[model samples]
Target: MKPVISRSFLDRLFAAQDYDGLVQLSSFFQGTSTCRLEKADYGLPRPFFLIVESLVWFAQADRSGVWTYFEATSAPRQQAMLEALTAGAPAGFAQAYAKGVSGWRDEAGMAGLDRWLSARDDENNRWLWQLARANRAQIDELLS
Candidate 1:
């Protein structure tokens, strides 16, 4: 049987900017669906439906915390995390991407992530933007 929220639902979930609605939808998904949550599935149960749903929700609810997680994490690995977050990949898939990008690390790459976060205009993505704009020192302090 198809999951309560299918690939199309996941697609819309990724594009959703309304943080409140996304939260409700995610809750509905969790309650009504048989799917299991996995970071590798982008917080979804299925790979193709990876939507970064959890991270987006978490980012919306707590920007500083997300940034702290990013700052405390390695740059290259974090780049992959940022990519997965942006690309709307399955939850834990980012770790694999981080492993792939382990060879390259630079301030420019880090800055690019900032720009990417800043450029996101979606309502759901705004929290990510907020987290991105937060000062690194502040993030470190808040997270620490």
Candidate 2:
């Protein structure tokens, strides 16, 4: 069974900007295993985006850590998780997984995000992309 992650832990890590802790937590998502989220304890009622944003921040903080985690996970498993997370996500959360995994540009997985975005024409998707673009500098600064 996969390890269960409490929303309180996520809240503490994110609030403290604990990139190392976030990377360590992501290791639980490796391989074909799924990590369970304790949704009720989350800072926000809907915690999916909160988790995704933290993952994205961690990926930005340490590209090698993100690459290592992805390398250990199968493509199909990764794709399934991506689809599930983005399916009915709110505006900025639409491309969360894509933005997180796209850090590994040398891999074919990056192309999937481009394709996914290309196929979408919704306002939320557009706003998500724009928000990502606008926050690029801030994201980089956080990493620095």
Candidate 3:
């Protein structure tokens, strides 16, 4: 019931966690042209956009592999995703993510991503969902 902000299509997409729907919806928003998660400039609410961005990265990595994410994403976008994680996830969550990137630089590239992936047990990222739920009114209002 979060995102009680707007009555727009964004409200439905966010509440459903409709990944593809949100991706498509984002294109009509302010900052995205390619609907890339790393764009991070959706011109929506800050924490809302950050949460969605972080989850999209999580979702994409879950569908593909973490290495695939790293491979397909540019360094700046990777940095943006990391920043999104920092903004949206619990403090503990950021540690594993940051560690993986650093560990990859430790010359254990694939291993680093694998470790990070394994460390994340909650695929749904209920914590972030909870955040959205808590701020539903604000998010929805903004979208509206």
Candidate 4:
């Protein structure tokens, strides 16, 4: 199956990290079904599912949106995690799986995501964290 979204698209979206852009992009993803479909794809890391999930949350409110943008843009570790996941996963399962299996270092990615989202000082970061949490929960459910 074709991947629903592009890594560059996500990278740009994350890089933009603006409330207006996030809402626009989130709406686009919601309309296109990119985030939901991508989450369902078995080949990608569950953490990414969380990233997008939090995006939806971030898109919901004007103030929260600002926080969302601030957190994503300011947090280098989170960005690095996203970058690593992006490099490994890119835009498709075919690529993501190949890189994932060849020692793609998913644990660090997950840990980074977990730390960023779970931190209490980051009310701004919670939306993304929730998304990540949801993704992990889904994967855990599947594994269990």
> RMSD for each model, in Å, please?
13.3, 12.0, 5.8, 15.3
Q: What is the lDDT of residue 88 in candidate 4?
A: 35
Off by over 4 Å in 2: 1-65, 90-96, 99-144
Scanning candidate 2 in windows of ten residues, the lowest lDDT window is 39-48
Which scores higher on TM-score, 2 or 4? 2
| Residue range 1-144, candidate 3, lDDT tens digits | 112223656556666764464444333333333233434344445555555555555665567655555565567655765776777576666676666455544434555556566566364355655656677676444445
Worst 10 residues of 3 by lDDT: 26-35
Q: Distance (Å) between predicted and true CA of 86, model 4?
A: 29
**8-97 per-residue lDDT for model 2 (tens digits):** 654454455443543443343331123233322122212333344345433433444344545554565455546545665554443645
Q: Which predicted model would earn the best TM-score?
A: 3
lDDT of 4 by residue, 14-107 (tens): 5555545444443443443233442333123445433443443234223332233333332433343445445433244223222323322444
- Could you estimate the TM-score for every candidate? 0.36, 0.30, 0.57, 0.25
Q: Report residue 117 deviation for candidate 1 (angstroms).
A: 1.4
Better of 1 and 2 by TM-score: 1
| lDDT per model vs. reference | 0.40, 0.42, 0.55, 0.39
Look at candidate 2 and give me any clashing residue pairs. Answer: none
| Residue-by-residue lDDT tens digits, candidate 1, 1-144 | 332444454445445646554454445444433434433343333211222343442453245323444444455434435554556543443543343244224434444433443344253345442332333233222222
